[model samples]
Target: MKFEFADRVNRLPPYLFAEIEKQIKEKKAQGVDLISLSIGDPDLPPPPFVVEALKEEVANVKNHNYSFSQGEPDFRQAVAEWYKKRFNVDIAQDQVVALLGSKEGIANAARAFVNPGDRVLVPDPAYPVYANGSTILCDGEAVPMPLLEENGFKPDFDAIKAKKAKMMFLNYPNNPTSATVDKKFLKEAVEFARDNNIILCYDNAYSEVSYDGYKAPSILEVDGAMDVAIEFSSLSKTFNITGDRIAFAVGNKQLVGGLTKIKSQVDSGPPVYTQKVAVKALAAYKSAEPPEFLKKNNQILSERRDTLVECLGDVGFPCEKPKATFYVWVNCKGDSMEFAAKLLSVGVAVTPGVGFGKHGEGYARITFTQPKERIIEASERIRKLFK
Candidate 1:
């Protein structure tokens, strides 16, 4: 039987990583020993304490039931405490909503706020979910706020101010570009959102993944950010539990309420057992300093980042060592897809920049999530091919 997808479903762009996975499969089927740097998934295991806590939680039969759409009260409190301790920002339980993942929270937040024909300000060369997964699904027009290399891969607020939009999405310690921002810039974002009455969706998923004494800030750290912004943070990167699907949205009670309402209709919140484990994970933060587990994790990632960047430069793909995140955004200097294909042919896979957005056309993003030795191996493969 033949069937057709809805117009909105048809309008959705192909998920980029899905294409990468397909390529990996094809290469492996042909006997290639592919080293994939295409995805940001962490290769590290969750902390031992997290695993032990999960074991304890999973043993409780009471945790088998569906969780509140708003989240378990203790989990919300843990989120609030973490925000306070990490950012010195105050967050109320009412202002927090647990999510299966920040991906879904972001999409559902758009559902709660965006209407057909409404315009959303999205950064070009960003995580596609802000545009494809959220704005387009709501039939909203996505105005590209290009993050040009000249501007340090940050949106031109001057250009952004000129356009009217109902919402804007910004991610720092950013995914594809690995751009980092400070409170001063976040203040500017808050001011822009407040002046324009735009709902700012701040993706802080990579906030805990910074290196070299650089720390990422929450938009809520800015005064009055709670008036117009909601921040999404996930334990996936921090605790290396991506598959556990534990994340939360905080700030602006009304906005949180709206997202919670949307989630209630669509699905239950994150698993109760997972939330219990996440509570233990969040408890590891007693101060502004990251826990020992995270410090050690970041140290390893920093090592890998250094090795990959140096090797990429050696292999004719010169790029800056990003201060944050596990990605190196290489200047392909040509067609990104072609560059990625060349790497794939050599059994090293990286994400094509064009798959991210039009502004990303001449670059590719490589992840340093693998061990340092593996990263060196991938770069050696590239060096051989490029030379």
Candidate 2:
């Protein structure tokens, strides 16, 4: 007999990064020296303090046990305090839900709120999780909100077919596009969510990995936002703990509770020691003076962005310097896949924009996740090939 699969899994579109990985592997097999500019994962080590914290806790057998479904209180408390220090938004201790990562929280939240046929508002050229694992897995319909270049990649609120969407996913200092929104637009989004009874989920994963004096704000900073919004954050980009899978979901007690309920039924929780390590990392950030490691990371990213923009800009690629996020969104003014394929042919791998969403069609997103030397070399290669 043939094995059967769920309709939900079968119906979803192809995973973009997986396809990129396949092409990468194939190129490598042919002896191609591929300079990958695809994935947004950070390539640097986290703070020494975070690693030390993990080492300290791992020795304590007490931390080897299964953590609470709602997550450790110390971890949650540290997250809350970090929020207060970073965004100046007061969060009650109970409103925070510790997550394996923000990605897990996002998927669970969608499971919590989206019933079959419910509409989910996702930004065009968005992080794939919002439209894929979150919405489709819940049997919900995805409604795309275009983040046009004319609007600085901020959603065209007036243009969005204002409807009763159950959830709206937003990423600022965004992935793929690297668009950052100010608090004023955030206020508008909050009001819209409140009026429409929408659950606004802001993925501020790239919050700390910003550039050029740009500080990304949490949606919870807006007045009355807690009544309708839940913000997800990650240490993946901020502290280079991607492998650690540590993050938190905060804001809107009811929404956090809902996500927790779903998580409890599925998985117990991430390892307890990792949560302890997260506590130390967040508490360190709670200080008035930002850590040197974080500062150094952002500086390197900023330099990479400049180097890439200068090289690509010289070849008439029309890449605007993004305010935050290490990605520089470029419009190839042609098919995104074709452009990406061309880059791969020249031993440079990049993410095709159309893989993000329909509106991503003439664009490609290049990341600054590699070392400065590799980035410079990739830029030179791209310039030559693009010309």
Candidate 3:
């Protein structure tokens, strides 16, 4: 007999970034020196203290065991403390669940809250995981709310009201789009969730990667938000610990408990040493200022953003400068995949926006994850093609 795949898994769309990675590898195998601005994996090393903590914890025999399903108390307390300091929101330890990553937390949360055929509201040209997780894992329906440039990439509340969705996924300093939400919008979102009896799942992974005079706001910052929202955060972008696979879910106790229970059934907890290291990492975050290296990195990115805009402008493909995050969501003149394929031939790897959603068809996402010099070189190469 032949093994068969689950129908839900079979129906899922191809992972776009994985496809991009495979293509880039094939090109490099043939000796193409590709400058990749496709994925937002940070190139910078994490803080020294984070490394030291991991090293120290790994040597402790007690830390080698499995951690609590909910999380170690100290780690939960540390997360609570960090939220108090960073977002000025008070959270109890019971309201938190340690996750392998924010992505896992999101998928698990969708599983916990959504029943089969339930309606899930997702932002268009937004992160693909939200819709895919809901549709494939939870067997729920995805109602895409188109995010237009005219609305600064925010979904219209009226549109959401019309859909009568049961759950909504939101991410600010949003991936692919790099759009940030303000206090007024957040308050409105909280109200919308409360009025509609919807569960608001806020992805806060990029909160700490913000630049300029802007700070990324958390959904929990709004009054009554805790009653209807659950926020997921990761150490990936904040501490450059993507490989560590440590993140947390914080918010409504009942919701957190639901995800924790589901997590217990599917997977064992994160390693004890990792949680110990996370405690140290979060503690270090309390008094730590943004390092000069990141400031320098942002400066380099700022220059690259300007240069790319200027170069693309000359090519008749203009883009807006994102205030925070390291992505430039560019409006490609025609089909995004065609534009990306043409650029790839010139040794520049970019992500086609259509991979994100239908609304992303005319766009492409360029990351500033490459080195400064490579970015400038890529810009020059792209410029030559259009000129």
Regions more than 4 Å wrong, model 3? 161-164, 287-300
Per-residue CA lDDT of candidate 1, range 1-387, in tens? 999998988999889899899989999999998898999999999999999999999999999999999999999999999999999998889999999999999999999999999999998899999998899999998888898899889997877654568999999989899999888899999998988889999999999998999989999989999999999999999999999999999999999999999999999898899999989999999899999999999999999898888888887778888999999998999999999998898999999999889999999999988887888899788878978
Better of 2 and 3 by lDDT: 2
lDDT string for model 2 (138-240, tens) is 9999999988889988897777775868999888978889888999999999988888889999999988987777789889989999999999999888899
Best by lDDT: 1
- Please give the RMSD to the true structure for each candidate, in Å: 1.0, 1.1, 1.7
TM-score of each: 0.98, 0.98, 0.96
Distance from true location, Cα of 146 in model 1, Å: 0.5
**Tens digits of per-residue lDDT for model 3, 1-387:** 998888878778999989999999999999999999998898877778888899999999988787889888998999999888878899999999999989889998988888888899888998888999665578888888888788998899986654557789888878878888898999998998999899999988988786665678889999999999999999888777898999999999999999999988987678888898888777755433444544555666677777776777777887777878889898887899999999999999999999999988888999987777888899999988888
The TM-score between candidate 3 and the true structure equals: 0.96
Query: Each candidate's lDDT (Cα)?
Result: 0.92, 0.88, 0.86
Q: Which stretches of candidate 2 lie over 4 Å from their true place?
A: 286-289
Candidate with best TM-score: 1
- What is candidate 1's CA lDDT for residue 322? 92
lDDT of 3: 0.86
Give the distance in Å from residue 333's predicted Cα in candidate 1 to where it truly belongs. 0.7
Candidate 2 has a TM-score of 0.98
Candidate 2, after superposition: displacement of residue 80 in Å?
1.1
